[model samples]
Target: MRKTITRIMIPVVLACVFLAGCGTLAPNYTRSAPPVPVSWPEGPAYPATALPAASPVLSEMAWRDFFSDEKLKALIGLALENNRDLRVAALNIERARAQYRIQRAELFPSVGASGEGSVSRLSESLSPAGKGETIDQYGVGVGLSSYELDFFGRVRSLKGRALEEFFATEEARRSAQITLVSEVARGYLVLAADRERLALARQTLTSHQATHDLTRRRFDVGVASALEVRQAQTSVDSTRVDIARYTGLVAEDENALSFLAGTSLRAELLPDAPVNSVTLLDEIPAGVPSEVLQRRPDILAAEHRLKGANANIGAARAAFFPRIALTASAGFASDDLLDLFGSGTGTWAFAPRIDIPIFTAGSLRARLKTSKIDREISLARYEGAIQSAFREVADALAQRGTVNDQLTAQQSLVEAAADSYRLSEARFSKGIDSFLNVLDSQRSLYGAQQNLISIRLFRLNNLVTLYRVLGGGAV
Candidate 1:
């Protein structure tokens, strides 16, 4: 009996050794495509002239430090804590973590306990006895039934995919965070620009009103004509119209800011102050272009997804091979519950199973092909993301130069218009020019001023866009 048992055990052990030597049950999948070139034509080259010398490349500066306004900081903090989108992102992270845990646990065995009882009565006619009899039986058992040994590394590969997925989800959450910060900052900037415009409109209205009153007095004294008074009235009315328009714009921007901050009540409570005026840094610190792959959350997420796709291809190919499973159980069972734990009632078992796939109606090959195709799709997407990122950064860099030039030109125009308006007003007071000339100058000046404000706002907004394109927020 001992020799017979040895013979069976030896063959089983040798089979396990042979299977182990078969290496990974999964096929090795060569990457369908080469890695995307990190250096694209649109990528920022070293020593870019557009980069400002003093502009610090956006780092993971706490939003509070970057914003600096106490109120804005408080608002951002509140949003981070309460934003619905952020909350959803956080929950997704938790879900991914749970999935990873589940996958990791599959590498371990499962244990269980069970108990059962039954009573039956049989007819005496079926037995040697001529009377009916009842028998009661009870049994209890604690055992580990089946546990797969990952000799072929299938479980390990699954765990690796799960880990990658977890990291990818984290990257997604970070991307959400970066977007949230940029959106809030941009909205706040819009509110500030609108407020500035509204203030300018009101100031213009007051000046026009004074001019109108002066013209009316002159006309009553026979020094100014009806035409002069009418022109002054027109200027005042137009300025009032501008004031109304800007007032509406301010209200709308405020509402937008409130929505972005995630609290309507807090938005209403914002301080009435212009956006903090800060000089644009002459130079911006731009790290190496390759660093973008590491710093940008979306890029990182894409890379992880690609990795997952590669792993899935391996898993798919593995399905065509044989699967091995080992199972063992040790327990106590007896007809009498009182004897369940007795030496005679002890029982145990061990089993090793191998399932070889001989045929599957072409399904296995089809699945493997599908997985390969999906990996190729993921590779393409990854390359596309890199190209898109490069283009965005390059576009932002190109815009910086153009926006700065526009701002400078607009400033000169505003100054020239102011000078022209002053001269026209003096000439009209001396009766050397018609009121129409004064009105024209005033209109030109107002338009120029408004344009300058818009340019300034655009420059600031472009700066925000540049930062975002460079993957500045949330690290």
Candidate 2:
């Protein structure tokens, strides 16, 4: 009996060993290199700062380290914890992980134990004894069913594709995290800028109100014409309208920030004044464009997708080959319940199946072609992601290069405008110039100041853009 059992198991064990060494039918995979330039584009628009030999890579930095304001840092933290988009991204990762596990399980057999008992009555016409008789059978066994032998690497390729997809999802989650940080910071900056604008409008209103009062008194004393008093009133009314508009804008900014943070923000944690200062690092080195491909999560995700598509092609190719499966069981069987596990009641079965693709009406060929096309699509998307990343970094660097010069020129213009307004006010007070001159100068000064604030905001926001494009704060 032992010899008979060993002879039956030998072929099964040999088949398992042969299948274990089977090669995958999938094509070899290699990363599609980025088609962008080796170095950053150079011109007056690009930063001229010396490339430090040992400066820390920006992408590895933490968000708290990148942003200096305590309030802004806290807000970023709050958004990271409570943001709905980020929460969804995390859940997506979990789902992908589970999916990968499910696919991987196909590479192994699932063993189980089952038991059965049955009784049946036979009619006398059908029985050799020519009488109705009852028969009983009992059985129990441990075995596996329809376990595919990976002789053509079909299951392995599928598992590989699933694993790559899981990695891609992880990268997507990282990309989502980085985007959330950038948006929170940008929203906070916008709120600060609105507050600054509101304050400027209030100050202008106060100055215009005082001037209106003076012009009215002067008209009462017959020292000023109705035209001058009316112009002064015009300035006051225009400023009051601006104040009301800006007040509404500030509230809207707060609401936007609240939505991004995914939680109600405390008043004390908010910026009280326009953002005059921040803790962003002085410089972010724009390394080679190819370097960003490795750092940017979106780009990494795209590449992973391409690899998964390549693995899928292998699976599709394997479909054209024969699939082998094995099902086996060993147990005991007897007619009597008490003799189910008796020493002489042993029973066993071994079944091996092979499915050869004889005809499919071109379905197998179509599937293989589909997988190849899908791989090509993924490759195109990966290259496009790299090109898009290059453009964003270049644009941010261009803005960085010119922002300081723009800020300097704006500051000089503001100074000159303020001086011109001061002289015009003095001349108007001494009756050397018309009231219209004072009004013109006041408008010029106010316009220059507003422009200056806008330039400052642009400069700061550009830094945020650079950080985002470089994949900073994504750890």
Candidate 3:
């Protein structure tokens, strides 16, 4: 008996050793190169040394520190707490974690207990001579039913895949968080810009009203023509129309801000100041471009997805080989309930089963092929995500430089236009120029001021974009 048992166990042990040597089970997935151009266009030249030596990288700063306004920080905090989209993303992470737990459980043996009772009459034709006519059956068992030994590392690979998927979901949540922070910041900046424009419009309306009153006095004294008085009236009326339009815009922006913050608080509750009052770093410090692969949440999520896809290939390949399962049970049962636990009524069972895939009409092969194709697709998508991220960073950097230059130019134009309007007014008052010149000067000044506000807003928005593209702050 011992020799027979050793003969059987030796082959089983050798088989296990052979399967263990198969190695890794899953295909290796190397990081793919990004599809975007490695080098971006150099931003407009600026004095590199002009930036403060102590200035920190934008990504190194916490968002709360970067946005110093107490109200704005509170709003962001509320959004993070109550935003529906962020809550959904967080729920998905929980779901992924649960799935990972389920997959990991497969790597271990499962134990269970079961019991049954029945009474039956034996057929006369099947019964032996002198046998009882009726028989009672009872069973109770503790069992390990159909436990698979993962000598080929199949379960391990699957667990690895699930873990990667869990991480991927976590990264996805982080990506959503980054996007939310940027959105709130952008909206806040827009509100500030609109408020500034409204203030400017009101100021212009007051100045135009004064001019209209002066023209009316001159006309009553027979010193100005009716046409000059009419022009002044038109200017005042147009300015009033702009004020109404901007007032509506400001209300709309406040509503938007309230929605983004997940609250009913009015814009008045926010700080009433221009975004430029918050100091942004003079220069954006870019880390190594390759570091983006690790830092960017979306890119990391994509890579994890790729890893999952690769693991699936191994699981599919496993289907082509035989599956082995071991089952065992030990228990006691007796016809009399009182004797159910008696040693004489004890029972046990053991089974080792093997299922070979002899013929599947190419199904297994096709599944394996499909898995490989999916892995390829995931790899491509991962590469694409990286490329997209790189482009976003490059685009933000380029826009920042361009917008700054544009703002500077627009400021000079606004100053020049203001001076021209002053000279035109003085000339008209001295009776050296026509009212037509004054009207033209006033219109030009209004246009220049509007343009300047737009440029300032663009510059501020570019900074927001840069912060977002860099995956938000360290928080």
* Better structure of 1 and 2 per lDDT: 2
lDDT of 2 by residue, 98-152 (tens): 9999999998998989899999999999999999999999999999999998877
**Candidate 1: misplaced stretches above 4 Å?**
1-61, 123-131, 215-234, 264-271, 276-283, 473-475
lDDT (10s digit) by residue, model 3, range 312-361 = 88888777766778999999889877689987999989998777799999
lDDT of each: 0.73, 0.87, 0.80
Error of 3 at 84 (Å): 1.1
Model 2: CA > 4 A from native: 1-22, 119-135
Candidate number with the higher lDDT (2 or 3): 2
The best candidate by TM-score is: 2
Better-scoring candidate (TM-score), 1 or 2:
2
Which pairs clash in the backbone of model 3?
A: none
What is the TM-score of each predicted model, taking all chains together? 0.85, 0.92, 0.88
Which 10 residues in a row give candidate 2 its minimum summed lDDT? 273-282
After best superposition, candidate 2 residue 315: deviation in angstroms?
A: 0.6
Query: For model 2, what is the alpha-carbon lDDT of residue 354?
Result: 70
